[model samples]
Target: MNKKLVSMFLAGAVFLGTLTGCTQPANEGKQGGQEAVKVGMVTDVGGVNDQSFNQSAWEGLQKGEKDYGIRISYQESNQEADYAPNIEILVDQNTDLIWGVGFKMGKAIEEAAENYPDFKFGIIDYAYEKTPENVVGVVFKEEEASYLVGLIAGKMTQTNRVGFIGGMDVPVIQKFQYGFMAGVKKANPDAIVDVQYANAFNDPARGKAIARQMYQRGADIIFHAAGDTGTGMIEAAREEGKFAIGVDRDQNDLAPENVITSAMKRVDNAIYEVSKRLADGNFPGGTTIVYGLKEGGVDIAPTTSKNVPQEILDFVEAQKQEIIDGKFTVPSTEAELNAMK
Candidate 1:
């Protein structure tokens, strides 16, 4: 493991107290007399196998299940309307803890938390200044990671033109967009970053169409923050003999030769840690945990060396250290990125 990853574990250690969020229910388990701690996950509209954001959260839950002897399952949301009903189903099951997988389900999670103060709930990609006592929110400085991969795009673009495809115009996706643009401009001021949004998170055909157009228009590299749609973009990269940067998790496995690298979020670790907390009897409710470069919450994926040069890797590491030490900040918004220009 990287030294920075170890720091991330220690960074979140402050919240591990004797008493926290939700208590385990009294339902009996097949193993010992102890009732198994049950964890239920509610995925956003992308479903559980989008090979991206939602999948990362489910990975965390599976790890927790193995390490903590907990019971875990997921409810897939095929559309926006599925959010509340899926959460309601989990609640009816008397699940010890429920996790909502994305920012799109924030409102539903918030309402469920409010309606059932006795039940514990958690969410990713969204935070609250003052949450209810039974809810936990985990957010990440995704821009920091996006910026790292953007540096690679800027340094490697043969045509001096790159592309950014987003799933939606949400703040969470914006962090990826502006951060990527910031790093590109910083590394190669003359480079052009063409940006567009799919307005949907699961449409691969649309993502492929956009990537094809960008590649035809002189972009040799492209980055996508659009969930399953990004999968199509990676496929397009493979077909076009170009490069694509993935988001949320390392997606090189999807197209090892085409995906140069990914802007990764340690979503799996975050979910595992929180699930363990719930099992241990301290759930840290009414709080939001924010992870950044310093916390190992976000980073450029390890596969970067597969395509990026050692010199660029060294530069990105130097920049990573600077961000960790508070010597610099990565822009997370459109206005902040514009200020850089």
Candidate 2:
């Protein structure tokens, strides 16, 4: 076994022992003195602190613990194969609700949900073809948000060449790529956009290599939907004195000077809301919830020193409203994006 997997297993064993007996809340709740809901999460390879959806999902658990009086714990997966073991450990701990924090864990979560029929499970970024009776799939209109940032990249690029780096070739990442590229083209029809896929979300070295190549190719601005890999893009932008856009969260602080903006996907809100439903005895099981710009599930980061012109900011805002009001719809697939042009 790999050292990282072994370490993750040991960590899971320790976490399981720690949470074994005390999975339920100690204090009696105001509602009929019932035990508090026990919520746990299993992270993807990115773990909990990747500063992406995994981190955002953990933050939601934290918020649930703080405000909703739910007991929370988590197990971090070191690789794709670790998803089942991590979730199974949480199940053994008697977690009432378990959240799998990435699309890659969809099958694992589904199997777990079936194996543990009494518990509720949630999976992010994936909607199963046939959701189990005890599962909810949470997804976002990531392309909608990415389109906004693409507009920024389109308007702000000094070299008339922009780029997009994706973590995986999955539809979720493709949404970010296609939407962003469309936005850039919408703003500057003549602009050139270069696209690449790192094929690994956690490989910062690969991300940096691709980002550097794009920068060298005269792409003054780059947008990355590569999770932790995107962090490498930010680093390259800073070193090369260029601009990069972040995804899933406001990552401007990663490189304030270089990160002009971020395409926000409110994974935290989705996690929190779903956890709340479970806690409130309103579990949205066997359902796929789609959150979009109108629901505040997707947006551009409000903070950062992009220093874009007021007109540009206003234009983006207007376009955002247009999207919400059905005046325009952002394409979510490569084929649709190509047809749009």
Top candidate on lDDT is 1
* lDDT per residue (tens digit) for residues 189-248 in model 1: 999999999998999999999999999999999999999998889999999889999988
Collision pairs in model 2: none
Off by over 4 Å in 2: 1-32, 304-306
Q: What lDDT would candidate 2 get against the real structure?
A: 0.85
Clashing pairs in 1: 20-282, 20-283, 21-283, 21-284
lDDT of 1 at 95: 84
Against the correct fold, how does model 2 do in TM-score? Answer: 0.91
The weakest ten consecutive residues by lDDT in model 1 span: 18-27
Listed in order, each prediction's TM-score against the native is: 0.90, 0.91
Give stretches of model 1 more than 4 Å off: 1-33
Could you tell me how far off, in angstroms, the CA of residue 246 lies in candidate 1 after the best superposition?
Answer: 0.6
What C-alpha lDDT, on a 0 to 100 scale, does residue 93 get in candidate 1? 65
Tens digits of lDDT, candidate 2, 127-233: 98899999999999999999999988888888899999999998989999889988998988889999999998888888999999999999999999998888888
- Count of backbone collisions within predicted model 2: 0
After aligning candidate 2 to the native by TM-score, how far in Å is the CA of 168 from where it should be?
A: 0.8
